[model samples]
Target: MTCFLIPTVFQAGSLSLIMGCTPNASHSPVFLLRGFSGASVSSSLLFLLFLAVYLMTVVGNMTLVLLISRDPRLHTPMYYLLRGLSVIDMGLSTVILPQLLAHLVSNSPAISASRCLAQFFFFYAFGVTDTLVVSVMAVDRYVAICDPLHYHSVMSRQVCARLLAMSWSVSVVHTMLHVGLLLPLNWAGDAEGNVNLPHFFCDHRPLLRASCSDIHSNELAIFMEGGFLMLGPCTLIVLSYVRIGATIARLPSAAGRRRAVSTCGSHLTMVGFFYGTIIWVYFQPPSQNSQDQDMVAAVMYTAITPLANPLVYSLRNKDVKRALRRLIGCGAVDS
Candidate 1:
């Protein structure tokens, strides 16, 4: 509890500092290519890799968004959640890709302190937003499968809109709370700025470690925000799935039950991967010190999963597949 409690105060103060209020930069050395242990990487290879992933993530998510929007068949609560997820994927990737590309190509790959904070701000913002969006999806599915008659009214258009709005608002408040407090910590000036992040983007723990001053505020903010953000939505997802499972279990026919389970299973897999990697990365102590391990987790959430969302939700889904076939009007979509 103390671990969770302390960070809340730090986040509160940090948020106060980030409202166009500049803090003096600490003397953290700008490492252009530190090593795999730190975020150091060769300009050419990293940029190429980032470019490929960026294209895939954008194209995949955008395609899903388009398919859902254009098709009348997809005008349901579940597809709406997928659409929200696609938008978040687009946003989260865009927020990080440009700066990452700049850092990889430029000889002096350095982000200004303020810009770094801004990157972390939106990174966490949209990431949290995506998590909540998926949680909403779980609830939608639960209602749809568990209580069919009420599903229409319960997850109606207005209700869906409000949920999406609330999710975005909550994400903004939480991200701003942590990132804003993070801006004030003196990083460059202090000698403790040796911590290097492995990934391309600026993230909370990595940026916090780069601070050269007292990290009491930084550590506290990390613990509180990380705990609340990860736990809150995760709990909601679990609860929704549990009820959904119970409902599926009650299906009269075995085939019906199997179909219901399969439909929900893809979404559940996505939820687990997204939440699992993110929680492990942010919540665990760094002493696990697995740079390789950490990078893998980062790739799962940031790169791989975004690419997989369309495939995971749309490809396997009967409704989506049918809509896509109608939209493309081809013999069949490429395997």
Candidate 2:
């Protein structure tokens, strides 16, 4: 992988002048991304493994999207939101995996500054989209389980559309702030004149850590805005599930309780899986051992979680299975 560096003395001098820090003289247009180092596994093998996972992630999420669209049975608000989630999953994986794979094969793996910013923008956009969509899905489950009679009225097609739009808008604005703030800053390299990004992808933390500029404001934005964006949706999701659990407990029939639990099981699993890794990665205090930990957590949320979402939903959901079978049957009949 490619990496870049700036001297601390140069950084200090540039910081003194601020706008006087010339990009052409101090910074290379390309930044080196140090991918997994000291790996027991070979790069070729790593490449193959990541490639297979990427393909599976794309195909699985795309299949989920198509299945939800074509199947009339899945035309409900829940599935509509699910289709949106599937699209986000596909986008998230596509944003990182292709460039990552390309870097893995290259003798000199590096990305231009412009490309890095674009990658950072889309990565966080989809990530925030995932959080909001999950929160919305939790709300959908709460209505369906706790307030069944009002479900159709509350979660109308128009409402679903609005919610989806709102999710995208929020994500766009949040990422815009992040990228907007990052654009003007000067990044200084380490003592060796290199900016070393420990993790695989272009994450916010590594970039922040590597910068020579005064990052107090940037750090503040990450803590304040980033915290709310992540924590708010998580709080809503938790509250919705808590209410769902109470409602399930009050059901008169055992079968009713079973049905309610079954309806929410897939979503709960996904929420746990996605949020658990994220919290572990971002919320924890950084340490000497944190680099490897961060890389592993990054892989989980970016690659593994997206791949597993479709599996969890499809395998647990009989409706999706039936739809898939019917689709295959129709295709076979046409042949």
**Residue pairs in clash, model 2:** 2-32, 2-33, 2-109, 3-32, 4-195, 5-193, 5-194, 5-195, 6-189, 6-193
Q: What TM-score would each prediction reach against the true structure?
A: 0.81, 0.88
RMSD of each: 6.1, 6.0
lDDT of 2 by residue, 124-186 (tens): 888888888889999999999988999999999899999999999998998899898888766
The candidate maximizing lDDT is 2
In model 2, where do residues sit more than 4 Å from their true spots?
1-28, 189-194, 280-288, 332-335
lDDT of model 2, residue 283: 50
Candidate 1: tens digits of C-alpha lDDT, residues 1-335: 00112223334344333222126455433433232324456568777988999898898888888888888888888888889888988887888776667766665555555566677778777877887788888888888888888989999988999999998998899878876676556544324333344456666544544455566665565566667766777678789888988888788999999888886877887776666555555456546654454455556666666777777877678888787887789533433
Question: What lDDT score is found at residue 168 in candidate 2?
Answer: 92
Candidate 1 regions exceeding 4 Å error are 1-43, 189-199, 276-292, 330-335
- The CA root-mean-square deviation of candidate 2, after full C-alpha superposition on the true structure, stands at 6.0
* Residue 276 displacement (Å), model 1: 4.3
